[model samples]
Target: MLLRTLSCLCLLSGVCLAAQAQEEKKAAIKEVTVFLKGAELRSESKVKLPEGESEIVFTNVAGNINEKSLNVGADNGAVVQSATFRNNYLKDNGPTPRAKQIEDSIIYLSDKRNLLQNEITAIDEQINVIRNNRKVSTEEKGISTEELKKLLSLVRTDMKNLLDEKTKTNDSIMKLNTRINLLANQLREENNRDDDPAGQITVKFYCKKATTSNIVIKYVVPTAGWIPSYDLRVPHINAPVQLAYKAHVYQNSGVDWNKVKLTLSAGNPSEGAQAPKLNPWHLGFYRHTPVSYSQPVYNQQTSDYTNTAQAGAIIGNVLDNNGEPIINSVVQAIQGGIVKNGTVSDFDGNYILKPLSPGRYDLKTSYVGYKENITTGVIVNSDKHTAVNIRLQPTDHRLEEVVVRDYKVPLIDKYSTGTGRTITSDEIDAMPTRNTRSVASTAPGVYDGLNIGGARGDGTMYIVDGIQVYGARGINPSQGSNAYDNTMGNYVATENRGVNTTFDIELPYTIPGDGKQINVAVKSAELLASYRYYAVPKMDKDAFLQAQITGWEELDLLPAQTNIFYEGTYVGQGYIDVRNVKDTMNLSLGRDKKIVVTRDRDFTMRSVKTIGSNMKESFVYKINVRNTRSEDIELVLTDQIPVSYYKSINVDDVEYQEAEYNKDSGELLWTLNVEPYKTSTRTFGFTVKYPKRSNINL
Candidate 1:
């Protein structure tokens, strides 16, 4: 009897242990928070936990997860003991249904293309056979001349028909090839998920009693991110500019986000939140040659970039004054004296500044023993190449000179797109290392000084001369506060989380695992803007309409690509560079064709005279602004005089009429209120006295 009782207890313990074993439960993704460089996915499931120790395994999770970011929780008196994540290599996590369909379609198109190619081959063979018959007829023995003529005619007709059919078949094949290429491209985009095994998160929990408990799990994935973009629309010069903030969200996490609630955050989890430590800087002896002080000559050639709206590039060759290539020249695209993008010239002096948003930037090129040349107002268009040639002069060695050129706003802009979060000058100035790459790396999505995850190769079609081509924010948040305000827009809930700004989308979205961009509207607002017509007659005779908005900081904006719309017509693409914003933000609304501007040198006032050992050159520039529109307009005319960089060169007799003059930069700004059908004329003159042997470029 005692032996039987012990056997019964052993059986009961075995049953209890079996009941506490791990229970696999599939978790449904409930919500996702997409950051600038990563995303956090939250999933939940309900499972019954037996008394005492129990385990729950959540399967089919994101494979590209950051293991250290896993968090698990349970309800109904269940205490989480431990949790671990491991990749399920045995399970086959194949492509989604949509992706599979795309693959199948690609296969079908490829087969069709092969069949068309075979048809072309058969057509060629038929043409060859007809030619062979023609040759045989010509060599036939004792055939009548009329019979031979008829046979030749028949052969010629047959050959012509076969050739026509071949041409048609070739056309069909080309079309088929085009279709196949598109499908292949689509398949590639849809197949961008990581090849790692599916993830399984197992959580061990302790329960006081047997109960049904709800379990939730959350983790972060590095393969998902979003980029901000905008659309600035202006109804007219007097109306406000409508700002539409949007986000281009993308993910390749090996899991489809179907009907998942999304919250886009301006924070980047890839860059840790810990404050960076500063290292000591040790000074070393200067053994390298210094940069030259010679005068630089800049020439820019531009082409219209009206293709797909994507990031563009600036490509050119860096050469010396003697037309020799300057290898290892450092070329930078700068705005507000901050280097936004930079590249080093190759051995052949060829350099390509890529992935630049559509906007105007100053191109600065410098090399050892060569003077630095800065080309102001170089425009970059979207998906187009803009060429800018740099010619640096050799050092004169005798003269120690410093030249400061006045800043000029570009009147005409080319098309382009934008990316990269803006790092304010203040933030960079406070950093221990002020390196351009180091400072830009702190911005979201910038890794190792490169903007990653923003490249798109969708195999878009473009015809050029009948040829086809394919081309590619800091938020302040409270401490763990979840308070949000949804009064901004309908579909999105704007939340001012501490240290970050998040937009919680109200409606659920079906975002695929593909890494294609799906634009999501974040916020929209109509702010009061000041309008003025600006003209730099020295560079461009056309007048550009600019709008200035105050308190743009409240918009929580980052640097992004902007589409400009003026008077309900699409003007072009522009970039909102909020890195250097101050009291007001200015946006160019494109040029106004109705307003004409002209700058002419007054030869009558131009004179050169010798005074002792120095020569004095007098010059006068006249600017004319004609307003043809029916309404009165305000115009800002800008011009500049050369600033003396050396003590021997003196600028005297400066005369600017009703304009703001900056002595440091030698820039003259004139604001005029011109009425309709009226022409306004303004003149600014200056005299430069320099050494007789020295030449001044005016």
Candidate 2:
């Protein structure tokens, strides 16, 4: 009986032990606690248990425990199953029933509940203490009932204030939670909006990646405006991708967000049709409307510039191949297009153009007789003057014939006048001439011998380039006569002398390799006037004859016949020997005359001691001449004055005179015979006297 009883006791004890073991197994749960720092203030509360190993999400934990700053660990004796940080959240102790939920709930409400309870308790204690002090009022510190009531009322007011604050705080938390839930819902709704299910989309704005990944987006704000946005929609997932997008801002439309276009493709940068998109995506805002660029207007008044500014400029001269001035050349400023201005050269073949805006320009010159020339890409600047000297080829215009019109006579022929003629280069080449002066002689009435208004002559004034040659002769003989002769008696007449007073000394040779045109102006009447002034002789024959016929018998025997012999007879028989004769003579001798004797005498003639007693009268001759030609030419003037009639023949004020004949051309050219019709005048001075007959040895 005893053995049976013991077996039963052992069996019962084993069953009890097994039952305790099973209860212990049921009590062992995976306990996890997540501590959230810097979280919303709230008290701990029960949370619903999650099935299986569930993850807990915490958002916007305040304080310093941010997503990057968060750290997770197990309690000292507790096991840490798992922990993770994701989506800017700190999650710890996962895969635990009620652990994550309970901690999250505590984190949510701990501060709020603690603050509310602490305020309540503090207010209650203050009210109680004031009541106790009123109950034990002393002489020194007695608390009045009314004062006590007021203090209690203040406590109640404090409680109300605290409650109100708590309510407001709770309201804010609820609103924030609602907002977060709305955002989460919206995300969920748009999750499938992407066309490429396998592709993960990302939007980088101003270098920062978007908060959400694998999303379709629009209306992204740029640095300036809002624009449509896009992302890669492809088969590849979680791949680093780049997309280029264009945004436009219209002048009239403000900003067009819908106009954005994005491109996506990949290849070698050099071989690609377009450049690959780069990181830190650049958002370019292009103009929808055409952008009109305006140049700045510089105001001289204020010394300020507007939106646009004026460019600097250059100024300089343009020349030809011969270093001569190029006239009427087109100078242009070229940037994208051309702006042109024309300038012509002055008399010296010099030109100046100024104040050109700074830019690249082409200098093109065109003249009638020269080939057109063009110089490309002439950089002009304000700092320096651009000097462009262009050498132009000879044009066909030089070969063309130049027609010479007949010379028109001036209205007043008697007055001194100047003649102008235009002779082109072609005409100069065609005309025959010994020198350039001969070319001028082709004109009618031009004298070749004197080179006065004649072919190959030098009577005309010669001006070459801008310099006047020395010894330039005008048509008037007095104006151009040699400086030696001052008296009118020695003046030479230039009338009937074809004088080419105008010639170009600049280009003496007309056919000197396509020479330029020459302009000439001749003054014939002026030459004549000059000749009459300085070339004609002034003599007093009457006084000379009176001095010579001193004897009265010789005078009586001289005449009784005619008035011409009266003076001679008066001085011949009874009168003392004549001393001098004087008279004014205006003689019009023929073209070819040697000795010009005057018939009229005002007084008697006489013989001076210098001559013999038989000599009675004395006379002097004077002459002058001029040269007119393009070039210097030989000139000669010959006069025969009887030595018997003149005591002395003085060749005074003679320029370039020859003693004998000229070997060249077998012509007496003591006066220059120029290339053309040139005028030349010569003057000679002579003193004639008669010896007395008594002293004469026959």
Candidate 3:
């Protein structure tokens, strides 16, 4: 009986000791590693444990933490028994500094409102007393006119002051209300859940003896990620391009990352790791086979980005002539003539090819206007970061022909979630649609200019050459608490689009503008064109120089006026109409003074005018064209005859030589091949008969 009683007493004592030895500690966030879609947080706390088991209650943990990723580590030989996570709904955690400032302002305004209310009440009481006193005095004695007027004036003054005070107080109250509302909105926008009350993590630990132990807790949260940005710079057209690899890491994961070491990864963790399989290989005639798939056939991703763990990384810029970065430049690392890895340059003209095997490699760089550059004997060591900056020379040969046909090529996107189209450097340089919104409208599914895929217009995120065109306040990894401005560089002009990502490039070209069309040059090519001089001597006595460039269907160009730069000079502006053009494109390069054309009256072969009940007039004209340039030239001379509106006005004796006559339009054309320093002439005569005294302005 004594032993049983002693054991019960000891058990009670042990329970009492455990209740007393329980420790409550809060962990301070020590480090955070933010990924592309989420962020991992590490926090530490120190606690003194009893010789037996003790419960450590950790406060201030994120409420939306992934419990599966929650882990606890112990130092100083303290063994962790178990850990539990729960929201600390009952804890009276103090408000954040910003929130507290807002609360304090609210309190102050509430006090002011009370003070105003009290003043209004006092004024009402004073007003009532004044009325009563004035009535009593008037009833006491009938005053004279001057005394009554004075009394009335005194009463008016007191009432007016009271009313004015009330009006001022009401105005102040309204202003305070407005300010409070604004403050509330500001607080909400800047909240980021840093104002959460509390969260608790109760960890049970055991130890052989009493000792102080440090516990570290870690978990991942989903509200944080990063973006890869690039800056590619080419020293010159022939020089190698230098690409700068950078990351813009942003996090709102309910914690601040201060002075923590950051390690970025190129792999997407949330993407499911599953291989795709074909249903069956059955090519039959119009058979509606019940082909069912867990994942859609079109939804399968071809590239497996699982190489981030095996190889090292290579990052750098691709620049062009004049030391500008080239946007959308292709950078590939090849080994044994096979492309092992490749990446496109971002806004900053930067490219990062990660998980590259350590060995001697050949890097190939290519851009729309630049010549392909391949550097052999480039070495990449294992577990090391190599900067393989590449530069490519400019090519004068332009791709002038693009066939209009159906291509089964599919676009692959890794970061985007919606559909978008890519605008190549050649395309950007080809058209003169200077409006960014207009340029973006060229993509399919974009509506009303910048409204992409039917989303809100403001939701359209425009990223240029890795920089967000619309600025935002994001957490700068290098500066945690400062603002990082997102400004599109002057050279950022070319583009690529994807489901979730839209690229705006920092191009090597520029077009200066002020409220006018920014006729920027995205790229230029010397297309093979047949030049000719076309003259209408009978109409304007001027000849237009035209260049017909075939195979233009390949250049994705819009119909716009192009600034013609011919023979190393800005000749003038010309129109390019591709709307109805099929196989050939015609460009008018303004007028040519070297191919002079003239129209004159032929007095030597005189025409006579006869008058009677009927009138007849005959006129003779001559056209002369000279090719003064040092090269042979081809030309077409056009002249027109008047079409009479009245039946009485009859035309006859039309003389045309070696020219095609169009009776419907009354136009005559002559195709002429003239040699250098040679002149050609053509003469024609036409007679018109009409009623007497009829004026025909011809």
Worst 10 residues of 1 by lDDT: 474-483
Write one digit per residue (lDDT tens) for candidate 1, span 1-698: 99999999999999978846657788899999998767899998988888999777788697657766788988999989999888777776577575577667667767877887888889888888888888887898999999998998898788888888888888887887777676666555444443446788888889889988888899888667776766666655566667777776767676778889999998987567789899998899978895432433221111112233466789999876556555445677876544445655654569987657788999988643355589999999876789998887754422111111112332112222111222221121111110112221122122222221111111223432222222211112220001112243777777789999999988787776645445566878777899777777776767777677776788888765455455433443443447655566666655666888989989999899999999998989888899988788988788887897889998989898899999998889889999999999998898998889886676
Candidate with best lDDT: 1
TM-score of each: 0.61, 0.19, 0.39
- What's the alpha carbon RMSD for model 1? 16.7
How many steric overlaps does candidate 2 have?
146
- How do the residues 1-698 of candidate 2 rate in per-residue lDDT, one tens digit apiece? 99999999999999877634421101111111111101111111112222333222222121111222233332222222433322222222222222233334444455555565666566567657755754564333576779767866766676576667666656666654554444344333222111111111111112122121111111111011111111111111111111111111111001111212211111111122355776896789976995432556542211234342234443555555545444323343333332233334432335544435567877655443344577788787643467766565543321111121123332112232222222322222122221112221121211221111101111233332222221132234332111112232122121211321111112111110001112122111110100111111222111011111112221111100000001001000011111211121111101111112222222233223444344333332323333222334332233333323234322222222342433332222233343433433343222333334433221
lDDT of 3 by residue, 194-263 (tens): 4443457889888999999889998876544444432222111122222222344545434345445444
Which residue pairs in candidate 1 collide? 358-416, 358-417, 382-415, 382-416, 476-499, 477-497, 477-498, 477-499, 478-498
Model 3 lDDT vs. the true structure?
Answer: 0.54
Clashes of 3: 34
Could you arrange the candidates by TM-score from highest to lowest?
1, 3, 2
* Residue runs of model 1 more than 4 Å from their true location after superposition: 1-23, 103-194, 276-488
| Residue 175, candidate 1: C-alpha displacement in angstroms | 7.3
Question: Which candidate's TM-score is highest?
Answer: 1
Candidate 2 versus the native: TM-score?
0.19
